[model samples]
Target: MSTPGGQWRNRETFVREGDGIVDLLTCKWAREHEYRLTKEVWAFRENRIAVHFAYEWHDEKGRWFRSCGNENWESDENGLMRRRVASINDLPIDIGASLFHWPQGRLPDDHHPGLSVLGL
Candidate 1:
């Protein structure tokens, strides 16, 4: 996968081909109190999809951030993601400025305002 730092691949996993990536995610976000992801837009054609998304979360030190990104996914014949690419940017925000305040985990679609409504 590609990141702002450069191309990335796991060099530490002894099992899962990309388990190092999962490990990083778990270390960074697994215990975050406000980690939430919201989909802003999506486009699909055949085996490929493009997505625009944003998420808000806080680090262990309680510094808040809103991360926005675009991702491209290509699927194989079995409809599994064969390749994934993403570009992301993180912006620090005030702790009370979060737009996502629904109960942690799943956001109930019926009562929630999306990115457009919230003016993200």
Candidate 2:
């Protein structure tokens, strides 16, 4: 599957384990700065979930952007995500208009409204 930063790789080629997924995430995060993400589950069923997510980040040049997307995920019997499909769009935003204001890492649990309530 193609990730947000235009990294296109066949998900099937990678082993369906946490290591491969973590590698991909590490690479993605390494290229992104001040990244913050939020996801809201829209639907869920046995071994499958539908979610809408948004992430905010700034480029090396300090250009800020908000990437929004919807993803559908399928998991194996062990609850490991075996497949994921996502469609995303990026929009530029002024720094002053940015919504995510937490630290540079994982957001805190008390951060309310998330992307959905903020109409991201």
Q: Largest lDDT belongs to which candidate?
A: 2
Residue range with the least summed lDDT across 10 consecutive positions in model 1 = 2-11
- Candidate 1: which stretches are off by over 4 Å? 1-16, 30-33
TM-score of 2: 0.76
Q: What lDDT does the true structure give each of the candidates?
A: 0.68, 0.74
Clashing pairs in 2: none
- Which parts of model 2 have CA positions greater than 4 angstroms off? 1-27
> In model 2, how large is the Cα lDDT of residue 102?
83
Best by TM-score: 2
Local distance difference test, candidate 2: 0.74
* Number of clashes recorded per candidate: 0, 0
Per residue, candidate 2 scores C-alpha lDDT tens digits across 41-84 of 99999978999998899888889988888888876666655677
